[model samples]
Each structure stands twice: as C-alpha cells, then as structure tokens.
Target: MVLDLLVVNPNSSRSMSDEIARSVAAVDAFRAFAFKTTYMTGPEGAPPQIDGEETSHQSCDACLPLLKDPESEYFYKRYDGILIGCFSDHPLVEALTCLTDAPPVVGLLNSSLSFVSLFPSGPSSVITSNKEWVEILDASVEKKFLTGEARARGLWKGTVSSNLQVLELHSEENFGKIVERIRRENVERLGSKYVILGCAGFSGLQYKLKKIFPEVIFVDPIILGFQTLLSSATFLKCQNV
Candidate 1:
C-alpha cells in the first residue's frame, strides 16, 4: 500500500517546498515505506520565511484558504495525511484539524518533540534562526506539553540560534556554511547530542550535518512530521483490514 502525503510549506517560496520534498525523499523510512508526496507553497503574499509569532500568524492566515481551495481540491480530497512544514506548531495545524473530513495534520515541531521523547538518552537541543525565535518556540513547547516537562524529561535541553535571518538559510550562498558552523558549535560546545532542526528553512541540512558531525543525531522536523503522518495513516489502514 502506498501512502499519499501532502506537505504544505506555509511560505511563498517554492524553494522551501522543494527542499522539504528533497529532505523527506532522502529519508530511509520513506524509501522503505513506499509513499508518494506532493509539495505546495503557501498562497501569494505569505512571508518568505516564518521567524517569530507574527510571521507564523501570517503564514497560517495565508495557508488556510489554499487547504480548502476549490481549485486545489486534491488538498482536501486526495491525501491520506498532511504535513505542515514549519518548525513551530503553527496555528495551521490546529485549524486544519477542525475542517470536515480533514486528514491528520502533522506539525513539525509537535512531531519532532514527540519523537525525541521516545529516546531520552541525552541532552536534546534545537537550532533555529535568529534570537527572537527563542521565546516563540520555547512557549510552543510549554503550551503543547506543559511547563518543565520538556526539560525535566531531557526532551529539550535548550535552543541555540544560527544568528541568520530565516529566509537566508535557504539561499544557496548561505545554506551550507551557515548550518555547518552553527551545528558545529551546538555539538562541540553546547553539548547537544540530539539536535532538532528548529527551522523548516533548514529542511535539507540534516544530510550534510550528519556527514560532518557523525556523532550527533540531527532531527529535522519536516522529516519527522512526514514519518509521523505516514506511520499513523498506515496503522489506521491496517485496523480497517
């Protein structure tokens, strides 16, 4: 049985959507599971990158109509599951769940964090863009599971910044060098054994980082979100058999 998955990048950049697709396609899990994925960028006028709460709200607002658009009926009618390709639990995740006959909407942040919980072996950390996002994502972790649970269980050791703007991470000139430096510091200095790619802009960075660091487990939220949705959908399909 093949899984039909729709991954929505809540930004106007087609490159971001493409990166997400490339990353998910490269995962061993997806190759083993047999899945077909369609990638979509948010509607026109959405921000290029979601940095803090305001852009997160803007992206959510921009994406809601696309999900329900009559022209893109496949979004509503075809996929077994939908993955919101943003590192935060952007409001779009909850909003999509409220729609009638909506497939399971998996947010990257929620999926990655939940995945981290299963392996509580080391100090888990995140690498996101900019210092401003530090508080935005921290609140997300707290609101989803409750205060102190992430830290107390060692699910979230802390969050570090790349110091680059969110959109910059996707630029060809900035992608590799920037991600390598930040990840190196997080592994070498911050004691991040398990590092979450806290920005969706860092979609395809995992492969490169793994080659460089080798010891650290890089958790890219988009990849985890895809795995979560596919596994959940496959399980439900089995129950009906």
Candidate 2:
C-alpha cells in the first residue's frame, strides 16, 4: 500500500516548502511515501511569537479555515498521514485532525524530539535562526517523555540567533559556513549525539551536515514527522484487521 504524506507549511513561502521537499527526498526511508506540501495564506509568511500570545493565537486562527476546508481540492484523499512543518506545534494540527478525515497528524517538534530519543547517551542541541523560538523549543523538551533521559544523559542544549534572513540569501556561502562552524563547535564541546535543525528553512542543511559530521545524527523534524506519521498509519492499518 502507498502512504501519502502531506506536509503543511503554515506560511506562504514556497521556498520553505521546496526546502522541505528536498530534505525529504534525501531520506531513503520515505521512498515509498507519496509526499506533498501546501502553503497557508493569511499569516505574514512567518508565525509570530514575540508579538505576544494574542497575535500568535490570531495568526493560527487565520490559518484554520484554510486547514479545515476539506473540499478545497488540495486535500489528498490517498494521503495516509499529515505533517505540520512549523517549528512549534500549531493548534491547527489538532484542529485539523479532529475536523477532517485526514490521517494521523504529526507536529515537527514532537516527532523530532521522539526521534532524538532513539539516540545514544550524549547531549543534543537544536540549531535555530530565531533566538525567540528557543523558549518554545525548551518548553517542548520539558514536556517530552524523554526529558528524564535527556537530563540523565546531560545531552540537552538549545542555541538560537537573530540571523533568520541569512537562510533566504542562498548566495551567501559564508552564512552556511558560519552555521557549520557553530555546529562543529557545539558538538565538540558538548559531545552531542544528535542535532536538530529547528526551522523548516534549515531542512536542506541536514545532508550537508551529515556529510561533515558523519558520527553525529542530524534530526530534520519535517522528515522525522513524516516518517513517524507514515509508520503510525501502517501500524494502525494492520491492527484494524
């Protein structure tokens, strides 16, 4: 049976969606999964955080109708799973799962953390562009079942910076080089086993990083989330009989 994996980007940026596709393509585990991506309108192509909780709630609300419109033709009837590719776990995911006939919905953060737990003892750090998102990532880690394990392994570190736009300018090879340098420094000092790219825009960097640090496991939330939902759907189908 074929598994259709829909990755919903809660922003209108096509570049981010394209980056996710490339990252997903690099993973051999998803060869059998039919992958698709959709961009949401209303939000200013980026989810708000420092703008306050009310703004964040409103932005999410604006994306709801787009997410819930089942007959919108963008809906994939054959899709076996859905993945929300935003950094934080958007409420729209839970809302969509409850309202639509869509398959199991997986959020990027949750699935990435779950995947990270499978790694051996060592610290794990998240490399992100927006420093403001560090809080949300921390909260996610706090709520994970592997929190104890993470603490026990002393493999938890979170890093963020205000260099968000650096990703948009692909011509700036120095930006990527700087990021790689930071990753190398962090892994060396902390001896981290896993590194999670915190933003969907950073998805394409996984393969390059893997080549540089072959010993370090790189966790791309979009890929991990898609795989998690796909696996869950397969298991559910078997159990249903």
> Top lDDT: which candidate number?
1
TM-score to true structure, per model: 0.76, 0.68
- Evaluated against the true structure, the overall lDDT of model 2 is 0.64
Look at candidate 1 and give me any clashing residue pairs.
none
lDDT scores in order? 0.78, 0.64
Cα lDDT tens digits for candidate 1, 91-170: 98898889888877898888888877777677677888888888888777777843355567655666788888888877
What tens digits encode model 2's per-residue C-alpha lDDT throughout 187-233? 76556677777767677667867777888888887778877887787
Displacement of the residue 163 alpha carbon in candidate 1, Å: 0.9
